[model samples]
Target: MPITPVKSTKLYHLIVEQLKQLIQSGEYRPGDKLPPERELAQRLRVSRAPVREALVALELLDVVEGRVGDGWFVKRAPDSSLDVSSVEGRPPSDILQARVLVECAIAEQVAAHHDDELVVGLHQAVEAFADELRRGQLNGEADRSFHLLLARASGNAVFADLVAYLWDLQNGQFFRLVEGMTGNERPRLERYVREHRAVYEAVETGDAGRARDAMRIHLEGVAKDLLDS
Candidate 1:
């Protein structure tokens, strides 16, 4: 009997998870050319579409690269050395300064590219963020997704990778800060969701100027809140 068709989201996730295992297990070492599409399809028992989508997602994660005529190859191992503990006791000013520079650069690049798919992804991220906030959940994942979408929109792989790295470095600090700050005011979570939506709207409208300004304002507010608390 033939295998049943897999849902797109589930199929893609399955592909990603399997591929991750292969990489981690050393079956697919860095720079190793993946077997051709036919072989992959046969082995994974899925159609080419989900495999292709999974490849694109992995590429976004900087795990694999596709060469013009050759095939996909492993790129880099996921870096696990991001040291967030060291950031404690460091000046908040330094962190804010770094965020301002990185995010502003991301906004400018997204404005220049103006890719429709990227804008759509950003809008989805914003909606998800709002939903999470309404449920009284932390919006950190959505927040990170929004920034990653911006990095991808910028049309610069290096920028996207760097943003991912920075997020890994700072995400722990962010959660701790959020928990500490929300002790007295849970409603303030709504403000963060709104701020992210504002940035998304500005980018989706293709107003580069507005996008930059919105990101700047959001980051500045984060800095202020951190300092005030």
Candidate 2:
């Protein structure tokens, strides 16, 4: 139906198609609880990342809903108005993988040449983020400004714009779903603050290598806590 489903190479898209088939075939009816993440991953011969992304996509499409501490449940039938293609955007895991390469380099460069103004900016940015986080807003302006400031600290206009681009993607509706899925997990909230502080501390010490490593570890930890693990 609908021009053979929007063509794409994303793994979650393929999973979405498979799931659509299941729903259409009556294997997963409305009001039915689908298989758990591990079981679906096993069935598809993939890991949890793509599976989770697909489910989140479905959730965004209003095709399913996730009850706290429970798995996905079919909410409605897929009309021609809502197809697998409805879910679009790089998965959260993919965004983090890209950041591991780009932002880590930015952290390293900034550590080597930042001025007092930059250091003060980073400190303010970190606290700004912490303040918003304390108010329970994940996508607050301060959270975005912190990363952009880190890129700006590198003294490269291109780096700042590039980081902004990545942040835009991270702020996209589909990608934001992964974060919203984290809900109000207090440990996740505190851990993110601590990790951001670690990066700032490494940069403050002027250790380029340490700053890069800290960024990498922080991003990897985020992916683990939010997606993979």
- Listing every candidate in turn, what is its Cα RMSD in Å to the true structure after a full C-alpha superposition? 11.3, 16.1
Off by over 4 Å in 2: 1-88, 173-182
- Candidate whose TM-score is highest: 1
TM-score of 1: 0.59
The sequence of per-residue lDDT tens digits that candidate 1 reaches over residues 24-91 is 78888998999987789889999998899888988988989988788999997644434354345456
lDDT of 2 at 82: 20
Candidate 1: worst-modelled 10 consecutive residues by lDDT: 78-87
Task: Give the per-residue lDDT digits (tens) of candidate 2, residues 1-229.
Answer: 1133466878998898899889988988999999999999998999999999998988887888989888889998776652223544567787788878999999999898867889998999899888887887765577678889999889999888777876776655344455556655566767777888999999999999999999999888867765743
lDDT of 1 at 135: 80
Q: Who wins the lDDT comparison?
A: 2
| Model 1 misplaced stretches (Cα beyond 4 Å) | 1-89
TM-scores for candidates 1 onward, in order: 0.59, 0.57
lDDT of 1 at 160: 84
